[model samples]
Target: MLITKNIKMADVIHMNYFTLSVLNRFGIELGFGDKTVAEVCKIENVDVDFFLEIVNAFVDKDYFPKKQLQTFSVKLITDYLRKTHYDYHQIKVPEIESLIEEMVKACYSEKENLVLLKKFFNDYKQELLNHTNREETVVFPYTIAIEDAFNSKTLDNSVFDLMETYSIAIFQNEHENIEEKLFDLKNIIIKYLPQPKNSENCHKLLYALFSLEQDIIDHSRIEDKVLVPKIREMEKVITKRFGEKK
Candidate 1:
């Protein structure tokens, strides 16, 4: 739906179309990568002159440091996860839980419906909680170790290889599992929280589900597109160093 035709850089200074799209979708966009203006222009398919103009506008007026941007593949994933998904979980979990309890209270008179919804909520909570826990306990630690190895020039026996062979498989499998559960839970919410012709609580629950759905989709997109590639790149660096050392 975002057309790329005839939009001048001067018209939308300080934000690219990509940033604008993400901002409109998510309510805010983070900073750009450390890539040069030329590299950004190539990726966005904008003219160099226009891209530079936009960058200069952002730098002059917006005060964003292009040098400190997250340009590298690894840094992008780390930064995106920290800023977006991590923040989403921190805010959404308690908010959604409170609403879920309200839903339980409102639907208590409907014993069967309340019980069903409670069960679904329990499963949803567990799935997301486990996913976050794994990232915190295992994946992130391994990623940090890989980065340390990369930085220290000690690539042999790196965690990067282990993550590539095992951690990634475990994470991807868990993602698929969680995706299935989320799809099931989405249908349950739609069926149970359908827009009431006369009920406000029903409307509230529906909106909550919609927002949570969007956040989950965004979280998964960042993981699949950004995180996995970064892990693989770390693996490549480790393997290359090991070979050179041999």
Candidate 2:
């Protein structure tokens, strides 16, 4: 069911607890006693429609409204994406690391493989972090500038110059196939590893890996499908005017 503003804030949590991260990222704190989703969003000063779209997409895998998402300001979408990066770094990544550490400890035989497994995960983690860093430092800011300059009555030559050198297409192409690396890690644990001494920890470790993998997939879809195209359109408009100016 698509979440709407009139839905009670607590009921939205009941709809899908995964939205806890979504809510947290929006800077919506708890203790919004009896407030509807719209009321809480208003108090927190969040865009209610954007919040609903994000939450609905989170709850239902098939519910991403790409056309609608593109309608939002770059700052809104990028701000949410930045918060997601923080969630991955400060929370999800560390949680996965801890699970791996536990699995390594719980492996009775072929412990050496788990050590190697740790290395594999760390390499993937580092690659993902580097990708996130690039978006934070480079892609997001450039896109925001495009949006800003596109909307302004007078254009900024600096924005146009920067656009000439770097395009959103570069960011789109740079999206690495990290999912395969993550799938390999899962296969190693499921197929290759000996029965761990603590089977529960092994199960927990696998579950964590799966969860992070899914989250990354969803996150990438938003960037590749929505954000990049929006920026590309803005680039086209700017490029046309730039050609006229020249």
Candidate 3:
């Protein structure tokens, strides 16, 4: 699909399911009164170029531009990510968990199996929480430090020491593991679990699972395609600057 600034926000979302989450990052609400992307962004005071780059990235997985990333700020990316974490932990995850409980109570005959399913979900939730916490505490601060050091034109050799110990590579490696558990959770619901009596509840759970899964896939793409490359380039610059001093 052609993604031009003239395209309506609602039309773009209809064209691609992923666009909603991307626009949500900029706090651009839907029902845009049929306003084009450019119009909505202008009203919302969002950066048009950055918004277009992000929207196009989701629409076309291979469309990431390193130069465009240079124009972008790490803080902007992280703030979006942090809000995504809030959506998962504080909102989406709990909504799913509550739905699962309702399904369990509604299907008293299958309480035993439903209880096990709830346990599995709780486990997944815990793992997700742990992963986001690590990003917020460890990974994000290090990224910000790199950005600050680069901006200040101060070569802090100490930051390199931190990089050596806990780098982006380490975080990237851990990302797949977090995603795998979510996959397992989805599969268990689709294949293994018996259909609850209240089919509506089961459908609700499945819908939530599907939506969350897509959101996470898009989230991971941003990290891998956008954030990782940006930080890696920054790392190269910092390493070269420090190497010249020796």
Instruction: Choose 2 or 3, whichever is better by lDDT.
Output: 2
Flag clash pairs in model 3: none
Residues 1-246 of candidate 2: C-alpha lDDT, one tens digit per residue:
978889999998887676788888999998898999999999999999999877777777788655788899999999998998898889888988998898887676888878888899899889989989999999899989999989987868999779778999887787777678888888988998776677887887787787777777767877877798899998899888877887
TM-score of each: 0.62, 0.92, 0.90
List model 3 lDDT by residue over 1-246, tens digit each: 658889888888889875676777688887788899899999999988878877777677677544675568999888878988887887679889999989878886868999998998898888888888988999889888888877777778788888788777877887765667667777887888888777898888887887777777767878887788888888888888889978
Q: Which candidate, 1 or 3, has the higher TM-score?
A: 3
lDDT of 2 at 238: 86
Quote the lDDT for 172 in model 3. Answer: 80
Instruction: Please rank every candidate by TM-score, starting with the best.
Output: 2, 3, 1
- Output the better candidate (2/3) by TM-score: 2
Model 1, residue 81: distance off in Å is 1.8
Q: How far out, in Å, is residue 169 in model 1?
A: 4.1
lDDT of 1 by residue, 97-194 (tens): 67667766655355566567667777777777777777777776676677677677555564645655665556767665455655666576666454
lDDT of 3 at 134: 87
lDDT of candidates 1 onward, in order: 0.54, 0.85, 0.81
Error of 1 at 236 (Å): 2.1
The C-alpha local distance difference test score for the whole of candidate 3 amounts to: 0.81
lDDT of 2 at 233: 95
- The TM-score leader among the candidates is 2
**Candidate 3 error regions (>4 Å):** 60-67
Candidate 1: 10-residue stretch with minimal lDDT: 1-10
